[model samples]
Target: MCEQHRTDSALERHGAERSGQPRSCKPAEARRAVERAVTERCRATHTHCDPEALGDALLVASELTTNAILHGGGVTDFRVEVVAAGVRVSVSDRSDRLPVARDPADLRRRQRVGGHGWPIVCRLARDVRVSELPTGGKCITAVVALD
Candidate 1:
């Protein structure tokens, strides 16, 4: 696993407070770690983002990480960043398959136990992106606004 620590620096400026690591994690563990990372990033940045926003950010992070762990085979990398607008969480995994959200209407039609991740993520995040990593896997990024 690849572990990384990032801070505000001139040469390697990320324009935000951020930290990331590439590692394998189970669904439950990933959720806990994402929540912890969000807390740490907020404290480190000295930014008291809206409490509700923070909670939603943590939830979004957990959902994304869980999806990566369960659907993408394994979580290859995870990142949390405090940006001007809000917090951005990115999850990378071994699978190249992109995530799809079920139609909201269809979801009500079927009383299933699962498959609600991407839809919830889209609702909570200000912006969401999925891109193909050059090395074969895919990465999903979601941004939650502070306001």
Candidate 2:
């Protein structure tokens, strides 16, 4: 169970750790990972993939990874998998701050700046959790239902 998953990006991320290179901080890479995992799972189970659900999951993935990079001091780690409930996305980063959603409308009823990501994630994901890592920093996990 401790065996490392060896996808090309996984290899790259693992290699980066050994060489003191930064882990993947790109949201694009995270989305790709989620896509591959969910799509492959659907194929394996002979399940019809839900396009809207997949899109929501990908958007959630993108929001989480982007938040980790923009606010959590880059992505320390990431994982995506298919579970009975849905597609799960997890992202870790070197920050203790939990994600917060700013009010949609601020003083004078004007929109806020750059605070929509967290809310979008919450709306799309069926479940969201943030945990403190023993090694420091934090991990955020979100489950988006496929059906």
Task: Write model 2 residue lDDT over 82-129, tens digit each, in one string.
Answer: 778898788889999989989888889998788999999999999999
TM-score against truth, every candidate: 0.74, 0.83
Clashing pairs in 1: none
lDDT of every model, 2 decimals: 0.71, 0.80
Q: Give the TM-score comparing model 1 with the true structure, all chains together.
A: 0.74
Candidate 1 lDDT score relative to the true structure: 0.71
Distance from true position, residue 111, model 1, in Å? 1.2
RMSD of each: 4.1, 5.7
> Candidate 1 regions off by >4 Å?
1-21, 26-47, 103-108
Best by TM-score: 2
Shift in Å, residue 133, candidate 1: 0.7
Spell out the clash pairs found in candidate 2: none
